[model samples]
Target: MRPPVRLALAAAAASALQIPLQPPNGANVQPVLVESDALADRVGAGNLQKRAEALYEIAELSVDEYGHPTRVIGSRGHLGTINYIKSTLDGLGGYYNLSDQIFSAVSGSVYQAKLVIGDVVPSFTTMGLTPATENKEPVHGDLVLVGDLGCKSSDYPDTAMGSILLIRRGECSFGQKSELAGQAGAVAAVVVNSEQDEIHGTLGAPSPNHVATFGLSGATGGGFIEKLESGEVLDAIAYMDADVDIIETMNIVAQTTHGDPDNCVMLGGHSDSVTEGPGINDDGSGSLSVLEVAVQLSHYKVNNCVRFGWWSGEEEGLLGSNYYVASLSEEENAKLRLFMDYDMMASPNFAYQVYDATDAANPVGSEKLRDLYTAWYEDHGLNYSLIPFDGRSDYDGFIRHGIPAGGIATGAEGVKTEAEEDMFGGRAGEWYDPCYHQLCDDLHNVNLTAWEVNTKASTFALSPFALSTTRSTANAGWV
Candidate 1:
């Protein structure tokens, strides 16, 4: 947390009597639905027609061809992206509320990696180069092989300590296996795809500093397993470098204001991506699209406030956004009337999915937002349905705080269907976003129609919820 955070938190709590925390299960809440056409005019062909420049800016970030700013911990890309996000937020031309959330500890770097085998596959899976041992000297041992060596104690299966572990992937995260292998006393591990075909996957739980691990093809894993099952001892040369220390990361925040100095609206997106792939659709689409909305909202200030956030270390864990939420006092949290999080808005699979946000009988803000999204889809005659909140985005923070939170995404990891394209008119099988975490996600990959459509939806999502009054957050008494 930063000084401003502590000071603002103190101020938000000053003389404010503590209120009992409302449990989501018990709260008898009502939906504050903003069903209005206030933004319809601005959204139509006319105003949208004139905002080409702004649209272009948003496209540059969200579209796949231009390449997104993806940076990992302990990397130049990470630092560059941090600066880029900050600069973009500053460019929105407002009183920027920025802060840094440093990590609990710095993970050492991975150095000197080697695989002793015939033709080591170039592509592999491992948690992001976690701190590893660069043991240059080759260690000879009996090769113990297994399939999907998960964290379950049963996974050990009489495996020899300090021996190599050759396993295929499935039923667990890559990180789970790495941490589990480390605990199992395996000096090194060789993980291959469960199938011969390589399907990109998450290596492990988000961790900047974890372990030295890698992935392989089934053929490669099979070769090792065969040697092990045949009772043949194995020896391989491996090298790795691990650097442990403090690594710097940050959060990017921009705000637009309107009514009630005590209460405000929130919007957020993550600004980080994994290595190798620039996460244009994963979150770049969400972040920049919302950034553009923040810019437009700032230009035409409303009664309620808008705080646009670009969270860091999101790919590593909900680190940046969680830190911000953690610093908020209950009073400050109460003042948060609404939170709108946009993650992967232009998904490779661009279904108009409504998030499950509302249930009037026991209304939560997110539930309310979900209701709003569903209504919007119905009213617009769009094919969509709300999915459950699956702890896969930045909204996790606000939802946990009992604030009303909701947002949108195109799709990722999931495939697009022919019917979807027939309706939305895109390629089938290819997701709404094909280059989600791959290098292919550039400016060329964006759907122009989706861009315009989402922009219109965002106008509705943000504006009506706030008083449609004029600019000047101070006049509205909002901060």
Candidate 2:
């Protein structure tokens, strides 16, 4: 535990008063209250752009067989990302305590997944967590269309036996469809996108009960269905090759050296990306923003401990975050006053949205956090919206354990509305970020203005807590 408070001018008086005496700088001087506006003013577009460009260049360190650059877990690009963050923090002259949290997690990659019907090879991609076909060889079967959405066991007919099942993507998860089909004697599962575009998704997690699951564009899958409805026998062959194994990766945890360790404020963002792209806007924006804030924050002093987490394995699942939280001791968990998550801060078509903290499920003081973000936007004359307090990002682990959690996000795959367009001046009926998970999500994908604004908002919300956690008075003071 930290030594009891001491007054600088009264070493003799403090001893006479029975207060503990400690290091010259320890508890002797009045703690500085970090103001939102002043600290937030330090965040700018120029610096963020430099960080974004640096991350993009780091991503180039790892290229897949298809020549696409990525920072997926266990890859060179991701390792470079980890190293860059560590070296930057170390350069802070020991202002923060850094810990490299290493752990083993399941990682999967699909190199080849092809579906052929008759003489045509349809365009397809394998879903995450999908298994390789038996013997890593081709499996030929008759194409059989499953009824409805194919989420139910009865959706797979007896005719589906020894055949490849064609299922539509909707109303259920890909893993559930694959599991139901495999139980009905289907050799493989082809899930067609509900939309016109090609589907890119995960089965959510690995399961031996799942068959080789592949995603196809709605148009291509519809063509096959029409042929099947006409009572035509379509012969099909599916070849899928994937590597799923346990790999060692890490989460970077850093905390301020000065402050009450028992009272902490935490901020985090995922550090890894999907295999498809460099993932600049998806999370590189958030990760770098947090890193930049931590760097700038070192210039000031804090009362409550401030911790930053750069989580891995978020793209595959909330693996890193979940693991970290579960490993925390009960006492450690109690030290965390609140948790904030930052993600996709630079969506090309952006809307300033804060997490709704008034939700019945959210813990107390969450509304205060929500107020901080909305207040930041309002104080700056910037309009904002409220997104569901859903566990979609790295905030999942914290909120599950009843910790008050809140943050802001520009957006991701969700579509923008006309109202949002008016406020943000972007096209309606379009994704907040069109290149969200695609290879096009490079340095060119981020909107520097949106990134800077959101980063400042995050800074504003985090600064006050650094001065004094709502649960503690050790560092309480006005700026």
Candidate 3:
């Protein structure tokens, strides 16, 4: 530690003008999660204005970074999105020196094509669905309508044989969709966007014998319907390319082993995304936000061993994180204080959300993020919501290990509810991020408020628990 004068100079320069270095009580500091008056007083008007500006730039960069074709596990259109993430952390310049952990999502290849009004090349967006390079054959058939062909919804007449079945995307995993399509007698499936605002027209799953999968924009579909009404040919072609092997992807990790070795605190976020989209907000925001925090804190010699992880193969399933947890020795895992995963922290239009787990009835994670978020929102006077933890995040790994894990996510794949609209003030029935998995999910599409809520909420709650993780590890020994 430096001398009193040097420390004072360092604090003055390092602390955000709004936030002082030490607590009003001096050495005994209050955690930001508590929203103490001291904190509120420090974060005055000018300081907030500066913070908001910094936040906006970060959000823009995150969104910009996410959709830049960074596909881990390498698929069609998945460029160097992963590389950018790695580089960003490296460029952030710190000792949290990045490391990579590779894993596989393990899915079959898929191919897709489309046929709209002939002599007219129908407008389309070729999403992740790659046309099967190995198995391509010409087949023509009447379009069949298959509603929600989830893995369990064995309701659609088998459409995998020869006919073209029209299936809408919903309620099931992409892998499940491929399986369902294979079981059906249809040669290929044309999966149209379930919503009018869908950025991509078709969604194809990886599968064997999956012929051609195709997409038509909502507008194109409406026009096709008009053509059908007028007795015109609404013919189209689709193919599901299923010839690729399971591609292994890499995740970056950097460890700051401090605090108590027995108790560990983990910080992480996914570094991959859908084929067409850059995945910035879907995760870029959280990635950068967490990365920034990690870089800043890495300089400090803290208590409790801390690990920073960047997950891969999250777009397909929670695979990378799951594997890491599985690999840890039972004893090595015992000291886990908590896991805090930040996912999609910068939704351009996200409403502040919290994982509503361990309620008054049950307490989860370090201390249920509920109160932390509630206080943060109230102190800021922002709209807030608490949603259940449904294993939708990377924390799924910690949960599987019976470790109390908590996480923060600004928005993703699902649409917002009506009540949510009333609170956020966006279009009435649209999803929080329409550009979620599209190439359009670029840096330009970040909501300022959403970014702040996620970053601040996570930092405020996580830092204290992280610093004190050893307590949890100690308690775990008794359990």
Candidate 4:
């Protein structure tokens, strides 16, 4: 789902600016010495807040006529955001080596979606990347229930041919269910949520084998199931008009010009957003934090190479980071001392959550990375919690490659528990970011306290590593 962004500037401009028009190899760098605390002191809360507000303004200007302030990958908004970051780095006067890693991916959005069950028009959200209805018109068919969760091919009935398949959500991804429904000859697939509300999802990627897939609310879908159980045969109409295209985008990677390339410290945040809103809080917080740190670090020097990445296609499925990691050779991978990720650093109702790398999925030096954040928070008199090191963000790509990885998150759609409320002073029983992935995730979506604290914490944690990985006890053969 994560793809590339369009390069706003021409190759001539890049050449004129002395920017690396190609992907970076952390070459021609010089290392300087810097203290962790001194660098941390430069990451002012006011500075971060200022940049965040500017980001929101940029997002607003990028809004389409449809009223969506979307910085979704390959969109004009996203390209503008990338240009902003690149320009910021360029203004830093070549203190870092900058490069754009370009790649192609299918970006999609639903322009229109409609579902009518018999005489009733029910609410629905179209799954991204699902094929449009034939001619983008409503396809009328009998709604046939595909028994079970519709994970297996056998779960679909032969009667589903040319009909819309009503499948329950569970046991598999929406894409898997849609693919199976297509193979069974269903014209469209409606995946009903097992949970309460209507859901928004993706087919994961562009698929020729997918029909128009839509998600219906649990109440609406359950009502249909009950009517069917009562011997009612339903005729349904499904329509979807979507825009799906394979577009080229770029990942911005910058490393300190003077550092030990053989042993480097890296950090990253996704630069793209979902189709719904500007994603100011969801990631603008994180991306700007990295940018701020990278900018501030230009004032100092580092012993070990320090690289910052503003990844694209993360919202799609960590595509940018995955591609970047896969592009690395084994020796290059080994040269990476560790990677720290900053994702939603400023959720409205935030929790100071660090990546818990105790799980087997964690690489050799992950625990050390986790401890660094933990210690940093404690030292700052802030409460902290541990989130699983799952492949939910860009860190997954590096962790899977046996590189030590850790990061912080300010919670997403997940609800804030009473314990978290007690620790972070946010309301319990509410999502950490209520506006997450919505059109309202704009300038007001951030908790300034969470934004400031997390940004400072990130600076504290990364500064030491930038100096040298040997400062930590968990070195464990990391070269």
Candidate 5:
């Protein structure tokens, strides 16, 4: 069993004072319902900001001795975050059936990754699930330039055997490239970035067929390509020091005790950050928005059950939510009426992007969820665009089970287009969140206007469902 987390008095005080709790409407009496506007009015931007600021402080205090402001799964920063959330829920004083859903996940870290070609040593990032070098020693091999991206088995040359294969990123996943390289008897694989910047990504998941793989910057890769084109033999060394271990983490699932448990409305956001930063904007904005709404809703009564989940290990690929969904019994799964995800709600270069479940990857009832947010934005006189339900966030697991899922994201990583800029009023060329997954994703990374608007929009969509499932035809298409 995992150890219990202690509640902080400060968090308890904050929760109690931030919003007034209403007297419990007995389960026997027909529950009173609040309108979307009224519920949204109670969600304060200042309160959300306060929670975010506190989370930043917690993240700083929980950093490792090396001073990385991370709240990654199994890290102290994440533990602090979990405690704060649990304490806040506890302060709500029996309003919710709070649970600490515990699960184990593999946590990984790369201490160093470097690519040496003769006299030149260039920086590189290790791909996820890459095995560590023996005693931190470099792996030396003759560099063989594999024509094409090395995504296909035919792309690997005979020279790639007993040497390090150089492949470019694109056409397929890193795992596929690495697997292909290993199959070709390559000692190691170096996936050069197709873009200008260095590639910082994962190999999706662990595969025994994968050899050691590293992602290289385009400039460094281009220099090697030039050498190869000039018919120069390039002896290379790929060095990496990394470790992966199973770590225990918890997800907070809080449900109101006053409504019909058979028909449940679910909303959530990730509560953990990448190893590089505090992640105030990436998910702190979304998590806190849901938290603030949960707190405020304690003052009202709901006809249907409302569950708010604060998921951990999202930065590591939605581990917490996936485990939760996978662990659910058939009956429990049936009770979930709909799920709404709020992730990265306050990107600096924000767009009012609602999940486009109407198109590809659409789960049953997802279209209705999409229309709900679309209508809300239209009613509020706000511009909104459609973001594909790409299975990129915590919603993926829910959708995979054929559950109705929809949500909003301001933006992340993807560059803002001219059309998006004109619609949302931000610089077109820059990324939606420039500090995304970097050390700079601290407290100031959030756009307060975007945060507040998205938060209110989330409340507006959720309030109607809380009253009753009559507004949502989510069950019509459920298999």
Candidate 6:
């Protein structure tokens, strides 16, 4: 059960923010049984496009200090995103119960730093909550390579003392790597990306025991590793002038009031974007897609409850979703039968990718959700591929606590292969969404065709789960 005080305060906040709550629409219409095809057919491109444009306009109206529109958590743009979702649902006529889950997320206050290796200054991202350099002076030292991933103490060499450590990112938090480096007597740490893309990470919290750390792209780091392996000596300079601040944010959760509460089908996407851009395709695409589904779903009565969550602070390491799961009671946790996360649903160079729930980390019965999603694309004669069901999105919280979870994504920051090009008909070697985290991820960044297909896929995947008692057998009958 939601706390009465919290709900009251949330309502008060909405009122103070002047968010318009509309009367329920078509309250007298009789709800029909939820059939997969029928629900999926209701997902239209026109409405989806309108929502996309609305989100883009919201971002445009909420500019940051740089005059760039952003929906980062606690910003006017994100607040508008929240209001837009709330008002859309409120117009549905009391078919759903709405609540706000509030929390605080701590992030780096600023970034005024650089990392120079040899004579080259590769593009880099500053790690969150890491310490600033002393007096803003760049520390120059010999770059000592840490063995393996540097997750364990044995990986640090004795030569690391008084030197800058080059650590590969994997199997550990940035904080842990920095802590181990500090213990090894290293002055600073440089973590290389594990993938082809750039690495932007957080230390989870302020770590006073940690030395200053930085992140580098995979290509740049790989070059450094190759040189070091060939017995090349390298000099490095690292500096970070930064601090931390806590931002107040909240998650918007709405559930169908008429369905069985004990068995719920939950769907979510983060509402906040990176501070760099509007993030329409990165997440506004997913967020608005879910919003349109919620609006359409209001006309139906389900056997199982359907909950929708618009999470905040996901760009800061899924803090909003993490806080929500942690705040749930055992009984409340059990009420959630399954969770589906939709992120980056409309990448310009899009490919239909379903979450591979067969990974050992997920709970039992998750594969059924994957099967349901893939079957939808297959039935429609569409091409789809399996992506790792890693804890990179809001679903991370649900999966960690043994909840069965799955979802779809277009793609982000990942290079598309030639085979994927043959499968989805886009140019190979380019990023699935080149705009990704940049300011260019605006309305035009979305591929409308891909967005429509995935939105329909979401409708198909979610309908049966809302009507069945168990996750396993729900989609089997429908597909």
**TM-score against native, each model:** 0.70, 0.86, 0.70, 0.88, 0.86, 0.87
Runs in model 6 lying further than 4 Å from the true structure = 1-29, 128-131, 135-137, 158-162, 185-187, 195-197, 359-361, 470-479
Clashing pairs in 2: none
Q: Write the per-residue lDDT of candidate 1 for residues 157-208, one digit (tens) a residue.
A: 5664676666667776676776666676766666777665334544334343
Per model, how many backbone clashes are there?
42, 0, 47, 15, 0, 1
Better candidate number, 3 or 6, judged by lDDT: 6
Candidates 3 and 5 compared by lDDT, better number: 5
lDDT of 4 at 340: 88
lDDT by residue (114-166, candidate 5, tens digit) is 77877877777677657665456788889998888887889999888778878
lDDT of 2 by residue, 333-421 (tens): 87888888998999998999899976466766677889989988888899999999877788889878767788999988777899998
RMSD in Å for all candidates:
11.0, 10.8, 10.2, 4.7, 4.7, 4.8
Best by TM-score: 4
> What's model 4's TM-score?
0.88
- 452, model 6: CA deviation in Å? 1.0
**What's the lDDT of the predicted structure labeled candidate 5?**
0.79
